[model samples]
Target chain A: GDKVKQSPSALSLQEGTNSALRCNFSIAATTVQWFLQNPRGSLINLFYLVPGTKENGRLKSAFDSKESYSTLHIRDAQLEDSGTYFCAAPQGGSAKLIFGEGTKLTVSS
Target chain B: EAAVTQSPRNKVAVTGGKVTLSCNQTNNHNNMYWYRQDTGHGLRLIHYSYGAGSTEKGDIPDGYKASRPSQENFSLILELATPSQTSVYFCASGDAGGNGQLYFGEGSKLTVL
Candidate 1:
């Protein structure tokens, strides 16, 4: 069984629409981080949260340690936002992070 | 800018051959990690290091070995490459605490035949 699981393996959205991605953690996650892999296969860090919510431009992320889950919300999506999104959490008492399968997002104009 | 650089952006290897992926970080982070990404598996940690001379096994370290010789360099070695090892490898560096933000490299694409 996967320690970290992501929902909606794939998603499609219009250029100006909004969408949210979710991740469920079976491990005791104290903190969570979100990353976006662009078309060039480069991974970019989006947000790093500790059981709280953070907003950066059009992207907002929330992590709930008590519920063992996290959410990433994208507002007013753009073509540049079309990429694979991944959520990861640090392993208990270690620097290692376990990742979810990722959500492939496509923002079409 | 803080960066993590990986060599040989792409490589193709034969079975029973040796493959090495190297990572260098300019972030001065103490924690470094190597992870592999597959179609259904987003990213699984293969190995990690706390510092220059410390290496630790992650969730999936069976077919790979890792070395951290200095604060800025870490390497992943595959003694006997197999078809199952074909995937994109990523190296990341982070602060000492587990809750710090991580910086990842561009990734290395490896194909095994």
Candidate 2:
């Protein structure tokens, strides 16, 4: 079974709209991280959370270890936001990260 | 800033040939990991090391071997390459606390014909 699961495998949104991506962890994950893979294939770390929530510009993320889930919210989506978003969970006592099947986002103007 | 680098950005090998992929991290992190990303399977860990001379099997360790001869370098070896082993491989380095925040290298693209 996949320890990490991502919702909305693919999504399309009009620029200026908003969308949210979700990740569910079956393992006892202590920390979660989100990454965005751009069209050029460069991966940029978006956010790293140890439970609770954090916001940066038009992006916000929340991780609830007790509930075993995490969410990434995109507001006022821009064309530059188009990419594949991945959420990873580092299980307890393991330095290896288990990644989710990424959610591909397409923001059109 | 943390930096992780991988060598031979691209490689092509024939079946039964030996291939090696190398990774180096200047962060001096205690943990290094190797993962392969394919079309639908996402990224699957192949091997990881806790420190120098320590290599451990990951989720998909079959057909792959790893070497961690030093703290700064880790290598993935395909002793007998096959076409099915072709994929983009990424090396990442992280601290010892199991944090999900890992610094990754610009991946190495491998093709086994």
What TM-score do all the candidates reach, one by one? 0.97, 0.97
Q: Show model 2 residue runs off by greater than 4 Å.
A: none
Please, what are the lDDT tens digits per residue for candidate 2 over residues A11-87?
99999999899999999988899999888876788998988999999999999999999999999999999999999
Question: For residues B1-113, what per-residue lDDT tens digits would candidate 2 score against the true structure?
Answer: 67999989999999999999999999889999999999999889999999999999999999999999999999999999999999999999988877837888899999999
Highest lDDT: which candidate? 1
CA error at residue A16 for candidate 2, angstroms: 0.8
The 10-residue segment with the lowest total lDDT in model 1 chain A: A90-99
Cα lDDT for residue B52, candidate 2: 98
Alpha-carbon error at B100 in model 1, in Å? 1.2
Deviating ranges (above 4 Å) for candidate 1: none
List of chain A TM-scores, every candidate:
0.98, 0.98
Give the worst 10-residue stretch by lDDT in candidate 2 chain A: A89-98
Native contact fraction per model: 0.89, 0.70
